[model samples]
Every structure is written in structure tokens, then in C-alpha cells.
Target: MTARATADSEERAPWLPMVGLFLAQMLMSFNVAALPVSIGGMVEDFGVPPTAVSTAIVTYGLMVAALVMVGAKIGQRVGWLLVFRVVVAAFAGSALMMVLSPSVAWVIAAQAVAGASAAIIVPALVALIAANYRGTQQATAVGSLGSARALSGVSAFLIGGTLGTFVGWPPVFVIVLVLAVAVFLFSFRLRSAAGNKSVDIDVLAALLIGAAIVALTLGFNNLNGWGLLQATREAPFDVLGLSPAPLLVLVGIILGQGFLVWTRYRTGAGKVPLVSLSVLGSSRERAAVYAMFIVVALEAALNFTVPLYIQIVQGRTPFDTSLAMLPFNLTVFITATLVVRSYERFSPRVIGVFSFMLTTLALLWLSFVVTNNWETVPTILGLIVFGIGQGALVTLVFNVLVTAAPKELAGDVGSVRGTTQNLASAVGTAVAGAMLVGILSLNVGQAVINDVDIPDRLIAQVDLDQVNFVSNDQLREVLTRTDASEAEVDAAVRINTDARLRALKLGLLILAGVSALAILPASRLPGYRPGEIPETLVARDGPTGPDRDRSTDGTVLEK
Candidate 1:
């Protein structure tokens, strides 16, 4: 059958296409949540410190943020359908490499490639929805995608913990590979839509963005280890001989960013710049973008810190921690889906403002109520409320951002949205991680100062440099074997508890402040209801005649 005929005659249910897209999106989303669950196993398998193992997560976020625009440009140059197929294949290959990775470095490399490939698929999927659906159909498609992402996160925690326990960390990659293959096969059934004309992509622009992102990420990652006030540090400021350079890296980031801005203006009259600062010239759109950045950053920080608090402070296993947080995701999925369907009945601005308020309140409550008391109920309840608020907030922002852009510029706007979210996640994780490390270090130092009865020689033999690498279990074992008095063990426990509680309080406070800032932009969101039909559509004036095309049944195409 001719392509036009097939497009018109295709009788598949609307939900079928949405389901396939959701599965594809879920595979990518699952990896984000799964990596945290397998962090311990990864450290053991690769024989690396926990901090080193975490580089994989940090690099994945950086790569995704850095390459999203490049990926979108490639899709527009090629066909979105073609790019989608290639990306799915690349994702599978990357996952396979990760499964067989022999070292931490190889694992990180594989993740980076997979992250970039995943970046390509996300914007393409959104573009596909815009091409294939209209009106309420398009809204439903977008909502399903958002809902699937939330549900995938919840599944990742549960599935990763279970699989990692029995089958080991490598099996997590294996599962991802299998899912990628399924997505690829399903995508083959997609009918090709109208192709996007090729656009010039500046290679130099891509490189500058990637370099800036890496430098910023590394700098933030090192902030705690290298004191912000310390200006003259070594090649990498040695924190217990584990080098983390904050200042120099941040300087490089600033320089690179400056270069990018200069280049953008220099090449302005030529082909369109990779990112047009003009988009931000719109006050409403700019506000929405900034709000998204803050909301994602806050969510990322809270997600990272809360799980650590549960496992380290409360002494829960990974499985128990995952289970404890399940309700948060459940609430998010349900509330977000409901909000998407009924959005037209309420104003987007009102919904967004209300959601941000709830999120801020939840964070503040968490900061006050989370102590060493192991109070799981209050924490869980707070998280559930936070999750619902976050889900509504994100969905509302995404819909507003995508719909507000000119139809011709949809691809560009989607690229910006994806990249901004990735960068926000990286920044949030790094900041929260640095704070946690700092809290741990201070507690360790205090414990050492309080120790009595230790001989001067024995005290000298104790290596402060090794303390950062020591796990809680290892610390307990060390104290047990040292012939220390019960008072010493008690002191160690107290120090650990105090450090964890302090970290949680500080992290939640940061989240609350950031979430509150979201209101400023959220209040400016277009006051339209959700699922409102656009007055115009892309390609609305394109040619239509018998010579142009006709369906097999000789009816004008509807899709």
C-alpha cells in the first residue's frame, strides 16, 4: 500500500500507539531509578568506593542534558521515525555493553552512551504525538507519557531491589536490554508521518554545551569535599586522598559558558543558533522554563537524600527502603492522571500554584518531623503529599511549555525542555550529595575528638583519610574489633545519627526554598485549562488534492 493510503486506513486503537510510546519512555525512566538501587552491588562488583560508583549516575544526567538538542536536530535532519528506530537499537546495544562491563569505567561509559541515545527518543516521541493526534487525543497522549514515567520510577525501585538481590546488578542491564528490544519491534509498526526538512546543526555549538555541562557537574560534585572558600587547591583538592576539584572546575564551566554565548551571537545572522535566546524573550515562556528548572532540582535533591536517610539513619535494607517509598509514586501516578484528564475544568496557573504550595509545605514538614526516631508513617505521608504535588506541577509545566511554543518550533522547544530537566537533575544530585558527605565528615571528626583511653600511638595509627570510604557496617565492625568500651560504640552511633538528621534537615530546607521559587513562574503560566484545543495546527495550510494524495478508501486523511 502507498504510505498515504496506509496512514489513512490504519485502524489501530488510539491507546495502542500510546501504550507503545509509554513502554519506550518507561524503559528510559526505569534506568534512572534503578541505578540508585544497585549502587552498593556496583561498588562491590567493580571494587570502587561508593563515591566513584556514583559517577555513572552523574555522567548519565550530564550527557542527557548536554546532547538533547543535538539529538533533536539529528531527528529533524533525518526523519523522527528513522531516528527513533536507531535510538532504540542504540539503547539496546548500550545496555548489552553495560551487562558485560568489566570495570566501573566501562559501566560509566556504557551508561553515557545509553543516556545520549535515550535523549534522542524522548523528543521524537513527543513530536510523534503532535503529528499523529489532535485536540483531546493529543492531551491524553502527553498525559499517559507523564503518568508512565512516574509509574516506571516506582517499578524501578521495586524491580531493581528484587532483581539486584538475587540476580545481581548486571541483570538489571539485561532486563533493560530486553525491554529495549521490545520497544524497537513495536516501533516497526509505526507509519511514517510527514518528514521535517533538514536544518543546519553547528557542531561547535554542541561541543561547547557538552563541555560546559561536564564542568558544571564536576564542580558541583566537588563542592562539599573542597570547601567553597578554598581558592588554591591542588590538581584536585584531596579529601582524604580522594581528589574532588570544585573551584578550578567551576571556573572552566564559567569560561565555557561565556564562550558559548559569544559564539551564539557571532553566528546569529547565519543558520539558526542551536539554542535561540529569543525563546526566553517571552516573559511567560521564560518563567515556565525557570519554574521547571527549580521544581526538577528540588525533586531530584529530595529523592536522593530521603532514600539515604532511610537506609543509613534508620538502618533499613534496600528492599525495605524501596517499599517504604512506593506510596509516593503511587500517589503521583494517580493524581497526575486525574489532573491531566480534568485540566480543562480548572486553570493551569491555579493548579500549578496550588501544587507548588503543597510541595513546599511537605518539604517544610519533613524538615521538622524527620528525626532519629524512625518515624516512617509521618515521613511516608509527607512524601505521598509531596509526590502528588510534584506530579501535578511537572505535568502542568510540560503541557504549558510545549503548547505555548509555535507549532513550527515544537521540536526546538521539546529539546530545551528535555535538556533543562536533565541539567536540573544533575545539579540537584550533586548539591545534595556534597551536603551529605560534608555532614558525614564533620560527624567523624567529632567522634575522633571525643574518643578517650586510646593511646597516642594508637590514635596516630587511626587513619582519618580512610573514614570517608568506610560504610556503616564497616564502621561497626571496626569499633567491635578495637576492644573499645561500650561508651565508644554508643558515641559512634550518636555521631552517625546526628549527622544523618542534620543532613536531612538541610536538604529538605533547600528543597522547600527552591519549590517556593517555582510559584513566581507558575503564577504566570497561561491561564488556559488543560486539554484545550489549539486554534491552529501545524501543516494546516499544506496542499490537499487528489494529485497530492488519497487514502485507499478515497477519503481525506484525518490523522
Candidate 2:
């Protein structure tokens, strides 16, 4: 079909399936966001530490990151529609498990199941969108995906907090079940495509990749608990008198490189690689992935940090946490949806760099503004500004990625997107937790040593080295047990407050530097303009000669 023909066909296209696809995306993101909100409730119900709940989040991310490439291959080998429907049913089952979970272990298992389902659904969304839409409609559909993610996060904080507060955390997952059913019921409206039987799934590469990601997540997740470089009491084991956390990270990097080498070997031998290397075949696509990882990672960091501060440190309700986060999350949703409107007026280079600059500035602003009290105006304004930058970058990078690749490889694109995003989320949350706690320990020790009010002899009595985020109330209770005077306990509380706040400010400043460095990658983003759809489509559908009718007329309708 020509431009006019494709536009006409798009107008006649059924949009009901897009709703199902959008909901599928939302289901995954909402569940991820819901985990943090439910941390307080889960800690109370299961009598486990917040770290235990944090494990469930990491486990889910690990599963998705490890299996998503294999999942993408599975979708191509099996028909996308068939695999999609099956996984949707599995996701619903996972939700049922969430509702009936008896322990933190059960919750982790349930999330792992959901992550496996999402691994497939993530890739299927891109493939399905490719199968169903073309021309400008396709661009809009892709852009809407970013908005769907932002919208899901917003809904999770609002709805999850409400349900976790009043009803319970289990009831919060009921929302996921509802969305799953809605997606499953409407999935029949999606266009079906034939499976490519010729493609082979590379199991060896899968194992290597899975192991690499598992190592990476475990390493980062335990950086605080296990120790960053030296052995702490919590270290499961040691590596040459050094901490295993950093060792695992090193091993993960080596294994990751091995996977790349293996893939090249397979490709050189004329075998079908698990994922297409061409997805990041260009410098531009590689840069897009790099930038996407940083933005998403920062987003994950903020989402985890803010909630942990409010609900855990401040001992506030989830509702209060939600109220504090609403401005930022709501801004992300609105900006993600609206960012595409600027595509025609501004190049992605301009938008990408500007967005990174905005995020960098916002984080700097937030570093200065954040106090123990997050409800203040300056902090909220900083959050809103950061959200706008975050929202725009996510959508913009995604669009650049999708448009740069051929439509036939949409599943590969989706798999790459899923892996990068889930892995980033895992790394981001882990690093944020680790960095803050690490800094707090250092600051606390220094405060204890330097302040005459907090004598060295008194600090020596306490295990100040194994520091973690504790409520002021909890700290007071601990200090009361110690043979300390009233003035001493008060000083300890003051020291804890000042040190924790100082650590957070330092973390934000470091993150601001990272955001600033990401401007380099953003500079390399694809420069395809919105109206360049004709050229992009031509690249996909091929020249308008012999294969014109067969390729263009029913490109999406092929079975």
C-alpha cells in the first residue's frame, strides 16, 4: 500500500486490540510499582523485614531480565497470538497466587511466575503492534506504550497504596487479575501471524545470559547487606578476603561478555542467534539502549528511594507516601503521552539532550530541596520537573529505537527493551539502596567519632558499622536499652536524622552526575523525523515494484 492506501487502511483498523495490548503493558508495570507500596503491609503481615519484600521485587526483575530473550524467541517460534494468550492466562494465575500467598517466599514465587509471563508479553506487545498497525498509526501506538508504563506507575501508587492501607496487600494484586482478564478476553481481536518454524532457539546462549543476569542482580542487590568490598557480618562468604558482592558483579560482567562472544560464534557459523544483533547493529541504536537504561534506572531509583524514606524511615502510611509521589507520577503519565506532540517540531537529538539536561537539573534541585518532610512545595516542584524529563526521555528513546529497526524484527526490539528495562530496574533499586545505606554508615561513624556529645567510648558500645535505615522510634527504643543518659539518646536521634538526610542528599547528587553523563549517549540517538514515516515504511515493505501488492496491501494481515 502507498501512503494514502496505508492511511485509509489504518482508519479502518480495529482499535479494540490496542486496549488489550496497552493493558498488558500496564499489568506488568503496575505489579512492579505495587511491590514497593506493599512493602510496609507485607512487613507487618509476614513478620519479615522490608529487605525480604525487596527480594521479591528483585526476583521478579531477575526472572524477566534472564528469560525475556528466550521468551522473545518462543513468541517467534510459536505464533505470537497463541503464546500471548497463554501467558496472559499464566499471569492471571500468578495474581491468584498473590491473593493466596502464605509467606514472603510464596509472594516471591508468585512474582517469578508473573515475570515469566511478562517476559513473553513484553516482546509480544511490539510484535502484535507491528502485525496490527502501520504508518502514523504505528508511531502513535508505539509512543502510547511509554505513556501506558507511566500511567501504570501512577495507578499503582494511588490504587495500591489505598488497597494496601485499608484492605491489604493481597487485595492490591486483585487489580492485576482484573487487567489480565480484560486483556485475555480482548486478545481474540488481535491479528494472528504464522510462526516462523525456521528460527531456532539457542538454549546454550539462554543459560549463559540467564546466569549472567542472575549474578549481576544478586551482586548489586546484596551490596549493602553483604558488603561492597570487604567482608561484613552479613556476607554469605568472602572472595580473597574481599566481599563477594563486587566479585559477583565482576563475574557477571565476564559471563555477559561470554554470551556476546557465543552469539557472534553462532552468527558466524550461520546459525540463528537467540536475539538479533542487528537490533543494536548501529551506533545509534546502541546509544538509545544506553540512554534508555540510565533513564529507566534513575526512575527506578527514585521510585524506591522516596517510598522507602517516607514509609520506612518516617513511619508514614502508604497513603501519605502516595500523596507525596502523586505529583511526580502524574506528571510522568501526562508528559509521556504528550512528548510525542513535540516530535514534529523538535528533533530527537534536541529532545533527548534537553530531557537529560532537565533531569540532571531536577535531580540537583531535588538534592538541595529534599528534607525529612517530602510534603513541602520545593520537593514536590523538583519531583514534577524530574518526571517531565523522565517521561519525555523514555518515550523519545523508545520511538527512536522502534523506528530505527525493521518492523519484522519487532519481537527482537521488544525483547531488548524488556531486558534493558527490567535489568536496569533491578540494578537501579539495588544500587540506590546500597549507596544510601553505605553512605549512612560512613556518616554515622564519623558523626559518632567527631561529636564530643557522642563520645567514642559510647559509640564503641554500639554496632554502628552495620547500619541500615531504621525509624527514629526504633532507634530510640534501641538506645533506651543502652546505658545512656537522656541527653545521649537525644543526641543519637539528632545524629541519625542529620546523617541519613545528608546521605540521601549525597546520593541524589551522585545520581545527578550520572544523569548528566547520559547526555553523551543521548547525543547519538536516531534523528528520524516524524514525517520520515514514508522512508521508514519503504525500508520495511521494500521497493514499490514487484513485491508491492503482496507486501504492502496486507502486511499486517499475513498469516
Candidate 3:
């Protein structure tokens, strides 16, 4: 039998099934972007505090990190096509629930469901791509998947913002549901070709991993609150938000991770662990994984901060903000496709270095150009450059990681990649949020000093604690509460604007500096020609032969 026949005797062209999978994956990516845009509306509709509303975001990441490996194992057991279709259908249903949700609790529940489904769908797609395509074609499929994800991200913001403005945020979920349904219909064509095998899932390990992720993410999320209170306030008998005791969360994280390590060590004697920590036992893969974290952190920070700047500082409406980002998304989609096609021709290291250089330069340009009088043209151009660079960098990294792994171990590799990406995103958000808050606070204090014409001695006498951050509503409230004249309020407004602008500039500068550091590791990526399989691919599982049918438990079939 031919390789294609051996791989999937009943299926049609491999590319067709891949296309369907890609579209389903896009729905998950879309939700990630859409939630941020709709967060404010959710806050109002659900009457929840900012922290509570933000739970939707944290829970999504936590669920993906906790369950992705389990999902991958399940897919390998039942068949990728069955798992993909079922999970995607669940995702679509969850989205519909989100659209109809009337309360914050409902929204959180829906997001959790969606997140779990997404975790299953994503890793399965990675395994499916590995099984179906080889060489440059494999690289292209991976790149295309990355590009599609990026595009969906951009579209989620644009579409969600626009739809929310006209019909409210609920409609955005409805749109996602429609798209998911289309993908599901197409998935039917791919069923026969997918592998059906059996594997035992480590439920206890899954629980431990989930606990570890939750503790770690919650620790980072509350880090600022903890730091601020550490000096003045007594440490809560319960640390952060973990119950039972003051160091409960910290203890849980350490213990849970320890349990995971112990479990993996025990399992190594017989069955493969949920994630093969052994993959990074090699020096090269360790460095590659670290590089992946940095790249993801940078991307996540940029995505979060830039949109806020455009909407708040520039006074652009949400819809307009999304439209302004189109240039960036378009550049990413086009350039990423080009890079994937050409990656084999150049070293990944060379491509990665160039990508980082371009991204750093773009961020630097953005830092200079983001002013009170910023225009769409220059902002869009800078974003375009950043997007292109990020697209290429991410695609190259994904290709390297996937190709480096043994075929039997793709599920574990995908889990690690997914986990790293989520952890980086959570950390990046916390870091950026803290920096932005600190900068704004400083700016507000300076504005009070520079823009206010109040007597210096009188200003010194006023309690700084009495002053609040100046939002539009806060400005009005301050005018009503204070005995200040109209001119004084005007002066205060000017000072506030100056402080905000200054803070934005400083934040952008910091981001640019961080992006520049990516260049160092990117320079170390190995250069392999397009279409040429690396020595790693040849070493372990050479070309899969016709007689090699295997169960998910890694047992070869006797044909």
C-alpha cells in the first residue's frame, strides 16, 4: 500500500480535513479575543466588580492549561475526528449559551465549558496535522493554523466590538456559533481517515495538574494586591485567595506540582506520563521552550496594551479601534503564510532573529508615535510591522517544537506548548496591568504638581489620599465635592491628560525594551532547509510503514 493508503485508506485528500479542523480551531481563538472587547459590557450587564468579571479570562486559561493534555489523550483513544467534532459541537453550544446568558455566573459557566472544549479541539488538531502531513506540507499546515488563529483574534475584536455596539455583546457569541456549525458539517468528511485507538487516562495526574495551574495563575493574579497589603495589612490567615490558611495557595501550588513530579517519575517505569518532562531533558529543547515563553509573553502584552491605548487615550470607539487594527492583522496573515512557505529555505534561527529585530523596531516606533494627537495612519503602519514579525516568529516556533518531538509523543508536546502559552499570557497580563497602573498613578501625582496652579504650600497640606484617579465621571464627582472654581477643574483636567500621556509613553518604551530581548534566543534556532526532515525525525520513528498500526497505549498491532 502507498503511504497515503496506509495512513488513511478510506479518506480523501488530507488537506480537506485539515481545512475543516482549522476553521473549528478558529472559533476557539475568536472567543479569546472577543471576551476582552466585551468585558466592560459584561461588567455592566452582570453588575459584577472588575475582579469578578475578570474571572472569565482567568478561568478560560486555567481550564485550557489543566485539561489540554487529557483532551489530547482522549482524542488519541477515540479517534481524532470523533473528538474534534464532539468538542467543537460542545464549544458551539457553549457559545450559544453565552449569547443567551443573563448573568455573570452564566457567562463564567459558559466560558468554562468553551475553554474545556477548546482545549480538546486544539491538541487534537496538532496530532491530526502531524499524522496527515509531512515535511514542508506539515510546516505549511502549522503556519496556516497559526495565521488563522491570529486572524481570528483580530476579527473577534473587530466583529465583537461592532456587533456589541449594534446589538450588544451577546450577538458576538451567536456569530461564533454559526461559524462553528459550518466547521462541524465539514468535519464529517474526515471521519474515516482518523485513527481509532485506546489509551488509559491518568485522572489523578489530571487533577493534580489542574490544581497546580490554578494555584500558579491565582498567585500571579493576586501578586499586586498581595504586595500592596504586605507592608500595611496583616497577612490574611488565608494567603491570596486560597482557603484553609495564609500560605494555602502557595502550599497547594508547591504540593500539587510536587505530586505531578512524583506521579511522572512513577509512571516513567511503565506508561508515559501526561506530559513527558523528558523531552526537555535535552539542553536544546529546554532553550526552545524558554524561547517560546518569551515570544508568547511579548505577544500577549502587546495585544492587551495596544487596544486599551487606542480606545481610551485616542478616544476611539470600540468599533473604530478594531478597524484600526485591521492593518496589523492583515500583515500578520499575509507575511506568516509567506514565512511558512519559505522557512525550510533559511535557518529558523535566521528567521527568528530577523523577526525579533523587526518587532522591536516596530514597538520603538509605536512608543514614539503614540501621542494625544495620534493618527490612524502611523499607528496602523507600526502595528502592521509588529504583527508580521510576531506571526513569523510564532509559526516558526510551533513548527520547530512539533517537528522536534517523536511522533508517539506529539500529544504531550502539544500539551506543554499549550501550557507554556497560557502561563505566559497570564503572567504577561499581570505584569502589564501592574506597570500600567503604577505609571498612571505616578502620572496623576505629577500632573497635580505641574498643571495645578494652587499655592505650593496649600497643595502640600492637602492629603494625597483624598484624591482619586481622574476618570470622566471622577472629574465630575470631584467638581461637585470640592469647593474649587471652574478654572481649577479645567486646570485639573489638563494635568490629568498630561499624566496619562506621559504614562503611555513610558509603558511603550518598556515594552520595546522587552521585545528587543527576544532577539538573543531567536538567534540560536537551528537552520534546516524546507522539505528536509531533521535528524531527530529520522532517529526515533523512521518513516511509518504499512504494517505499523498502533493503539494509543503505544502498543503495535500484529497485522
Cα lDDT tens digits, model 2, 1-559, are 3233424444656777899998998999999889888888889999999888878888788889999999999999988999999999999999999889999999999999998999999999989988888656666777788889888988888898888877888888999999999999989999868888888999999999899999998998888788888978889889788999999999999989999999989988999998888767666678889999999999989988997899779998878888888899889989988887787667787899999999999999989989999989999999999999999999888776676566668898899999898878878988999899989989998888888887666777789777888889999999877788889999999999999899999999999999999999999765545543334344344311222211122231111
lDDT of 2 at 83: 96
Give lDDT tens digits, candidate 3, residues 360-442: 88889988887765455777788888888888887877777676665656666677778778878877776776577677767
Error of model 2, residue 390, in angstroms: 0.5
CA lDDT of every candidate: 0.70, 0.84, 0.70
Alpha-carbon shift of residue 133 in model 3 (angstroms): 1.6
Over 4 Å off, model 3: 1-14, 43-52, 191-198, 224-260, 373-376, 446-479, 531-559
TM-score of each predicted structure versus truth: 0.83, 0.92, 0.84
Candidate 1 overall Cα lDDT vs. reference? 0.70
Judging by lDDT, tell me the better candidate of 1 and 2: 2
Worst 10 residues of 1 by lDDT: 546-555
User: In candidate 3, how many Å is residue 117 off?
Assistant: 0.9
Cα RMSD, model 3: 6.1
RMSD of each: 7.7, 4.5, 6.1
Model 3 accuracy (lDDT, Cα) = 0.70
